[model samples]
Target: MADVARIAGVSSQTVSRVSNGFPGVNEETRQRVLSAMKELRYRPNSAARALKRGEFRTIGVITFTLSTTGNVRTLEAIATSAAQEGYAVTLLPVAVPTQDEVRGAFSRLGELAIDAAIVIMEVHLLDEARLSLPPHVKVVVADSDAGDRYTVVDTDQAGGTHDAVNHLLGLGHATVWHLAGPEESYAAQRRTGAWRAALEEAGQVPPPLVRGDWSAESGYHAGLLLAERPDCTAIFAANDQMALGLLRALNERGRKVPEDVSVVGFDDIAESSSFQPPLTTVHQDFAEVGRRCVEGVLHHVRENGLEHGTALVPTKLVVRASTAPPPRKVIPCS
Candidate 1:
């Protein structure tokens, strides 16, 4: 602080005011102080700053896989928002929330000195595990099914699936076959329910559903069965990866997309548009999901108490070349 002030020809108090973001510093003084800071390459100690302000200068975000597109996007959004708010983020990765892992994570978080935490566990059955966090630290659970006891932020998986299937039905398809993710996933369950409901409401029998573990391989296997079925015209895949696999399976079997079978996929992954024929899929705004989660956590942090609320982000259907009207009738075997 003394060195920077000497370099900038300013008082130490002026340097302090500039660094602490006090508004009274003149523009010229602020610029000079910043220039001095850059020349000195002096990095402020966050821990020391926190100690003086009674803050950690950081928040924790805990999630399973950082590699998944959805998870990555959500984390990025959270980090971006936190940075904008002048806070650093500490990322904690846990594979699956077991009782021990949940307990351990919270314990480690306390040692790290974070102001609050956000958990990105998206399964409905993890309600029992959500209670393990320390109550002193504000906690926000994303995609939670823990009732109103915990704050939650989640994309409208069911609503997106409903819109996708409804679009297919409106295109005059007989029925939309579903390729779902692992049965245990909350998103998969919601999507499956919505698909079934849409079919039921439309007076069409819902086609048999094939399960995938959110993997392209599983989707490829499911696609093989779909290709052989003459009644399979429109297919709704749980996510874009599976949809890509389905596309490959259909291509290999000499079935033309939209011409022979229409496909609708979820997540609207980045590569969806680059497929041989662009994919039509559902888009979940993951950044919005992250923002909501941060808001929930911040709310609790300020109040020092859990806020019981469930926020569902909206989803939209992106139409492309992957869907069209079904054939007039199944082509007879030669």
Candidate 2:
């Protein structure tokens, strides 16, 4: 800051204001300060800035995996929002959240002087440890039922699944088969429930559940299994990656999409459109969810208190070539 101030011929306070994005600073001055900052390669000290601002202006993100399309999208949104808000983000990955890992993360978070934390929702194993974080540490859980104690920002996973299955059934398909994600995922369970309910509501017999780990490979394997069944027609995979695999498996067996088997996937990932046949999938507003979570936490932090409620972001189904009517005859197994 001092170097920037010297180079820009401005006071340290002016540099601080510019760095913190305080609004009263003139455009010219802000630009000059920024230029000086660039020329000198000056960086703001987040810890010192936190001390001055009386809030760390830092948020910790806890997520089990960034490997999935949905998780990555959500995290990207969160980071973008945090940056816009002049907050730094620290991403922490815990493939499996053990008590020790959770404890260690919280301890490290405490030492970082972060103002709040936002944890991506995991269906299981994280709640007990998450609950143990200091009450004063503001937290917002994303896409999980953390109850009334923790603010949650989530998409309508169940609702979206219901809509998808309902769409498939409305197309005159007898019953929709499900390829669910890993058992522990909240999304997988919620989607499974919605799929089953849609079937039950129509008085149709639901097919047995097939399990996958939210991977293209897993979806392919599950697809192979479904392809062997003569009755298989309309199928809904838990996510797009799996759906892609299913598409491959069906193709390999000489089954035509929509014409032979209709499919719907979750998380309309970026490449869904470019797939061999554009994928029909659910679209989640991750940016909206991330912004809401940040605002919710900031609201609590500003009030010197907290209130916990869940934010359920809406989802839409994008129908594409991947889904269509059943074939006239049951396709023989290749």
Candidate 3:
């Protein structure tokens, strides 16, 4: 430190400020300190600095998997938002969805150097370990039903699903068939409930449900079943990838989209617009959800308090070429 200070012709405190990324050091002087450190090959020890500051300003993100679109996008958003807030994100992935695995992640978190945590998995395990953490640990939950036990930030899953179902009904389809995600996902459950509610609101009976694992393969098989049904005029998939597979199945079965079978999907991912006929789907503000999660953690850390309530981000329907009024009835020859 002294060597760099002497070379840069600046005090050790000025050099320290530039290295730690603290403000109040002007640009020219900061540049000089950085040059000196580069020339001397001096590296600041982050752990020692964090101890001196009494806070790591890092958030631990505990999640299960990144195989799905929602998980990956949400995590990316969290990292971006955390960086904007002058903090860093560390991922703690749980290999399995078991309660023991979730609990073990949180247990290991206690030994980590993070000042806060943003949990991105099922809250059933978190609920079970409510009192496991010390009083200083602050938490923000994403994509789970924590039930007011923790600050929650998530998309408007139910409302988006309801809009999707009702959109098909409004376009003259008698009923919309649903291809749902796995039973274990809270997001899938919310969408399923909303689909049922939308049908009941319009005084129509919902068709039977087909379950999928949020994959194109699952959706392809489910599409085959729907293809066999003559009255399957409209289908709503839980995600865009499933919609892609469903579209492929419908095409192979000679069912023309919007001409014979209209389709709607949730999560208007980037590639959705380039699908064979393009997709008409719901758009979720995943970036906004991530930003709110970081904000929730920051609020708790800075204010010495947390809001034990769920924060909802809005969603909307994005109409495209894939949906239209149900196909006209064909007149039978006498």
Candidate 4:
């Protein structure tokens, strides 16, 4: 600092202001200090600055898996939002959703320099691993049902499902069939419940539930069975990938979409619009969810206290070519 100040013909205070990017330093002086810094190859000590400020300017993110579209997109949004806030993101992927694995992740985060953490996983394990989190680190949860225990930012899963079912029903389908994701997923569970409720609310009986592992192959198998059912008019898959497979099965089984069977899917993934027939689906704002998670984390950090509640990012129902009223039940003249 002193050498740079002397070379730049500026006071140490001026150099400090320039290095820290504080205002009031004219362009010429700032350029001179920068040039001196370049000549000396001087870089500010981030660790020392962090210690002095009592903040690492980093947020740690703990997630179970990145294979799912939602997780990957949400993670990307978090990194982008954090960068905009002048904070860096460090990710830790848990190999499993077990309590022990979650605890291990938190323990590892505790040893790092992150100022806070945002957890992206089911809250059941998080409830058990709550004790393992570092005392000084604030936390915000994403895509989980921990609102009563911790701050949570998530998509309106139930609301989105209701929109999907209602959209199908409003189009004149008697009832909507659901192909759900794994039972263990909070999101899948919420959507399933909402589907059933939406049907019952509309005075329609809910049909048997179909289960999938969030895979297109599972959707294909489910579609084969559904294709055989003469009464199955409208179907809702849990995600876009599954919907793609469902479309293929329906086509191969001689069921034309919107002509024989209409289909709706959740998660308006990028490829959904290009499906054999563009899919009508629910659009979850993963970017908004991620942005809220970071905002909640920083709020806790600034106040030095945890705020427990759920913040839901709204979902939209995107109508496309895949949905239409059920095929007319033609009857022969008696």
Candidate 5:
């Protein structure tokens, strides 16, 4: 502090004010202080500042896995929003999804230098972690039904799924076939439930669900099974990666999308637009979800209580050439 003040030809108090973003300092003084800080490669000690302020200006992000699109995108949005809010993000990765692993992470909570935490994982893992954290620790969750337990920021899973299913049915398909992710997945559960509900509401019997492990390979295998079913015309895949594999399977089986069958997927990933026939999908506002997670945590940290419940971010159905009116006659799907 002394060296920076000396270099900038200002008092230490002036440097402090500039660093803290106090408004009293003139613009020129602020620039000089910042320039001096840059020249000296001076970085503020967040831990010390947090201690002095009685709040760590850091957020702990505990994630089970980053392999999935939703996880990765949500994490990215969290980091971006945290950075914009002048907070550091600390990653706490749980290699496995076991209760013990989650509990272990919770045990380390006291040692982490963070004011609040945002957890992204399935409901079961979240339950274990929730129990292990300090009773007063502020938390925000990104997936699953945390109910009244914690502040939650999630996409409109049910609404998006309903739109996808209804979109297919509205296009004249008698019923929509569903490609669901793993049963334990919260997003998958919501999507699958909505798909079935939409079908039942329309007086159409929902087709049997084809389960996938969220891997494109699993989607490919599920696709092959669907391809063999003559009644499967319109497919709603849980994600874009799975839809990609489904596309391949359909192609190999001589099924022309929109001609013989139509497909819609979730998570309008970048590659969905480039798929062979392009893909229609539900676009989850991951950026908004992430922003809300940070807001929920910061709100709790400031207010010192969990007074909020689920904050929903809306999803949209992106229509493209992949979806169309079903063929008039019974056509061989495979």
Candidate 6:
């Protein structure tokens, strides 16, 4: 600070105003200070500035697994949005989704220099670990149903699932089968429930649910079972990854997509449109979810009070080559 001020021919207070982006320093003066800073390669002490402002200007992100497409995309968006807001993001991945692991992650993040936290609650562990979070740290949850207890920002899981199922049903399919993700996942549960409700609302009996571990391999196994059922003309997989495996399985079994069997999937991933036949799936606004999460937490931090509610980002149904009217049954000559 002293060196930069001396070089810029200004008092330390003037340099501080320039470094902190405080208005009052003339444009030429600010330019001189910046030039001096650049020459000396001087960077302001963020830690000291944070102390004075009573804020770290950093947000901590805690997530269960980055393996899933949604989590990975949401995390990327959060990082980008935080940077736009002049805040840095610190990521802490919890190996296990247990209460103990979640609590530990919160404790570790509390010890760090973060003004708030955004938790990607793929599972229900947050419900059990809520009380363990630091009182001073504002928190916003994503992809969970505990909105009544904590502020949450998430994709409209049920709405997307409803749209996916209804699209299939609207195609004149008798009934749409579901290939669900892991049972414990909040997203999977919401999607599965929505699928069932959508079918029932159409006066169609819901078919048996096939469970998958959110892996393509699991989807392949589930597909094998559904392929043998001639009545299963249309299917909705919980995610695009599973839908990819289902497509391969159906192809191997000689079931032509949108000809013999139509498929709809959630999470319109990047490769979805490039699938062999292209995928008809629900599109989640991961970037918007991430942006809202950061915005929600920062709002609480600025207000100095934690607010609890749910903010849902809308989803879109992308129709592609994978979905169409079910095959017309051929009748033999009497």
RMSD of each: 2.7, 3.6, 3.1, 2.7, 2.7, 2.6
Please provide TM-scores, in order, for all candidate models, with all chains considered together.
0.90, 0.87, 0.91, 0.95, 0.91, 0.95
Q: What's the CA error at residue 308 for candidate 5, in Å?
A: 3.7
TM-score of predicted structure 5: 0.91
Best by lDDT: 6
Clashing pairs in 3: none
lDDT of 6 by residue, 245-317 (tens): 9999999999999899999989999999999899999999899999999888888888877668788999999
Clashes of each: 0, 0, 0, 0, 0, 0
Ten-residue segment with the worst summed lDDT in candidate 5?
125-134
Off by over 4 Å in 6: 126-132, 330-334
Candidate 1: clashing residue pairs, number: 0
Whole-model lDDT per candidate:
0.85, 0.85, 0.87, 0.89, 0.86, 0.89
lDDT (10s digit) by residue, model 4, range 149-221 = 7788889999999999999999999889999998878898899999999999999999999998788999999
Ranking under lDDT, best-scoring first? 6, 4, 3, 5, 2, 1
Residue 187 of model 2 has an lDDT of 86
lDDT of 1 by residue, 102-214 (tens): 76787888789998898877553343534455656688877667547777788988889989999999999888999998776678888999999999999988878888878
Candidate 6 clashing pairs? none
> lDDT of candidate 1?
0.85
Off by over 4 Å in 3: 21-32, 122-136, 330-334
**CA lDDT for candidate 4:** 0.89
Write candidate 5's Cα lDDT for 1-334 as tens digits: 8899999999998988888878899888899999999999998776777788888788988888888999999999999999999898998989877768766776676588788899896545533543344466788878958757777888999999999988998999988999999887889988899899999999988878799988999989998988887778899999998998999999899888979899999999988899989899999999999999998888888888876578889999999989999888875556
- Evaluated against the true structure, the overall lDDT of model 2 is 0.85
